[model samples]
Structure formats: structure tokens, C-alpha cells
Target: MITIILICIGVLFNIFGCVGLIRLPDVYNRLQAATKCVTLGCCSILLGVVFHYGLSDAGFKALFAIPILFFSATVAAHALIRGAYHFGTKLGEKSVKDDYKEVVK
Candidate 1:
């Protein structure tokens, strides 16, 4: 029931992330989509596993994995984007403003 719903939601997020990777114009945007969607999707899937398994060892492992996945994904994405920006990766033509430009300078 709820487990199935959560799994479905996670799958949808993963699908959207894949589509974003294909559709986005630049590395930064692609990284943003991949990081956010994939992190949420993985967390949701793990939560579904926890729900299905109760508080057993597997469930406990899933619970512990959630926060680790979230934080690591966010941090890694930020680092990658920052590195790309510093290395002179240009934004897409449609990009309006670089809020980081002033901060980085």
C-alpha cells in the first residue's frame, strides 16, 4: 500500500531526473536535476524499504542510509558545480543571471 506508493513516487523522480539530464542545456543545470531528484528518489525508496521491513536490521540500515545519501549527494553536487564554474564552464544561452558571480569574485 504505502510502500508501493512510495516506491512509485521514487521511480517517477528517477525518471524525471533522467529526463532532466538529457534535456538540460548545461552541466550545472544537469547536476542540479540529478542531485535533487536522485537524492529524493533514493531516500524515498529507502523509506519504503524501511516501512516494509519494520524496525528490523534491514529497516534500520535503510533509515541510516537516508540522511547519508541526502547530505553526500548535495555536497558532491555543489562541489562539482563549483569546480566546473571555476574552470570556466559557461552557462546556457537561456541562463539569465549568475548569482554566484558576485559571490565568487
Candidate 2:
């Protein structure tokens, strides 16, 4: 029952992540969506896998993957966003506040 619920939640978040990737206007926002939502969704699914298959090799792999996913997702997102900034990807028209502008000044 818990597994089913977790799977559903994961799927929902995955869908939202994909939608955000497609719908967001700028690279930074898309990266934010992908990193936050997809990582969270994938993590939940991996945890469910661990719970469903405890102590076995599959469980161990899932357990290992959780931290790897966390680390890699964060680092990759950071790198991508930084690269986008370096390349001068413009912010969407609706964006408020130029935080980076202030920092760079």
C-alpha cells in the first residue's frame, strides 16, 4: 500500500518536472524544475524500491543510488545554471528582481 502510494507520488512529480522543463521560458528555470522535481521524484521512487526489496542487492543498489542521485543532481544543476549564466541566457520577462545583477555589481 505504501509502495503504491509512493509510486503514485513519484509519477506525479515526474510529470510535473517534465511539464516544467517544457513549459518554463528560460534555461535556468527549466534546470531548476528538472533538478528539484525530478530529483525528488526519482528519490522517492528509489526509496520505495529499497522498502520493497530490503537487504537484497537491488535494495543495496537503490540505497547507494539515493546519495549519488542527490549529489549528482545538485552538482549538475549548479554547473548547468552557472554555464547558462556565463553564456548570458536572458531572464524571462515575468521575472522580478535581478539578484545576480546585484551580486555581480
* Top candidate when judged by lDDT against the true structure: 1
Give the lowest summed-lDDT range of ten residues in model 2.
96-105
| Candidate 2, pairs of clashing residues | none
Residues 42-92, candidate 1: write the lDDT tens digits: 999999999999999999999999999988998999899889999989999
Model 1 shows how many backbone clashes?
Answer: 0
Please report, in order, the local distance difference test score of every candidate based on alpha carbons.
Answer: 0.93, 0.89
lDDT of 2: 0.89
Misplaced by over 4 Å in model 2 are: 102-105
Candidate 2 has what TM-score? 0.88
Specify the highest-TM-score model's number.
1
- Residue 55 Cα positional deviation in candidate 1, in Å, after optimal superposition: 0.5
